[model samples]
Target: MTTDGVEAVFLETHNWGKAAKFFQALGFDLEFSTDHNSGQLRNGDGPYVFIAEIPEDREPGVQIVLKVTDADAFRPDPAVEVVTPFEDTHFGTREMTVRDPDGRLWSLQAPAKK
Candidate 1:
């Protein structure tokens, strides 16, 4: 599968409201929101920002979501350990999660099948 580039970056935050506001102040437009736990802000072309609340036990950092042409066909490099294999998500996309050598989380996703 070929990668299209980053689709979004999920930023774990203690306060989604403040985070969204901060990004908006910096010129991002609020595209969508959820009262449950997350919201999205976008610059319109690329680099959509998603902020979600997390428990204290979880680390607050960025999780990159890369867009792929076919997530099911993409395989992790043998040298790089994978945390999860491709699975269908409730949001309707197929996705997988992996950790790089530096331990940063990377999520690979494909557009939902129509």
Candidate 2:
């Protein structure tokens, strides 16, 4: 039930290309780019940043990723609603999503299950 710290932050951008370039100009190195509508940037240390392009109708915001010991075992608080249940990601992690009371999205992720 305890969180260590933020592992990443996902930012919804209207243009992934522009956003990536912007972050890169600010000293964030491109870790990788994916065809899945998103890319990752990092300062070569902890807390990587991710940018994802979404529909114009959707609001752009930041999603905080929390490192958890067991993403599957972690449940959302009564005040929050589960968006995506814990599932294995193609990038090799177990992740779950929830919408906080303020409507901000949060993700809980754990190392890939062995």
Candidate 3:
């Protein structure tokens, strides 16, 4: 399936509060902040930048989120690899994470089914 566009950029930081402040200072308007210390910010645009605390098992890195019209019907080229199957996210979205041949990670997200 074709992607709609770049949906967001997720950055893993050790300190969410400090990260949020830094981004806000750069003019990223706060969309919403969660109790979990994560939030979505944007500059009156479609794409957003999300800052989240890095999980214990992983190193801090940037993940690109691709917007898809239908996560359930996302069919990639047969030759393309599938790293993680699409699944529901705690934040109310359907997402799938995949790795490119060069080992870059990509996440695809769509609104969850009503």
Off by over 4 Å in 1: 56-58, 75-80
Q: What are the models' TM-scores?
A: 0.81, 0.74, 0.85
1 or 3: which has the higher lDDT? 3
lDDT per residue (tens digit) for residues 19-103 in model 3: 9999889889999998888998997776899999876688898878999889878898776677887899998999987778998
lDDT of 2 by residue, 25-104 (tens): 99999989999779999987778998999989998998789988876566556766889888999889988888877887
Local accuracy by lDDT, each model: 0.82, 0.85, 0.87
TM-score rank, highest first?
Answer: 3, 1, 2
lDDT for predicted candidate 1 compared with the true structure: 0.82
Per-candidate clashes come to 0, 0, 0
Evaluated against the true structure, the overall lDDT of model 2 is: 0.85
Q: For model 2, which pairs clash?
A: none
Best by TM-score: 3
Candidate ranking under lDDT, highest first, comes to: 3, 2, 1
Off by over 4 Å in 3: 55-58
Q: Between 1 and 3, whose TM-score is larger?
A: 3
Residue lDDT tens for model 1, 1-114: 456899889899987888888999999999889977789899879978888988878879887898888765676668767788778899788887878789887888887666
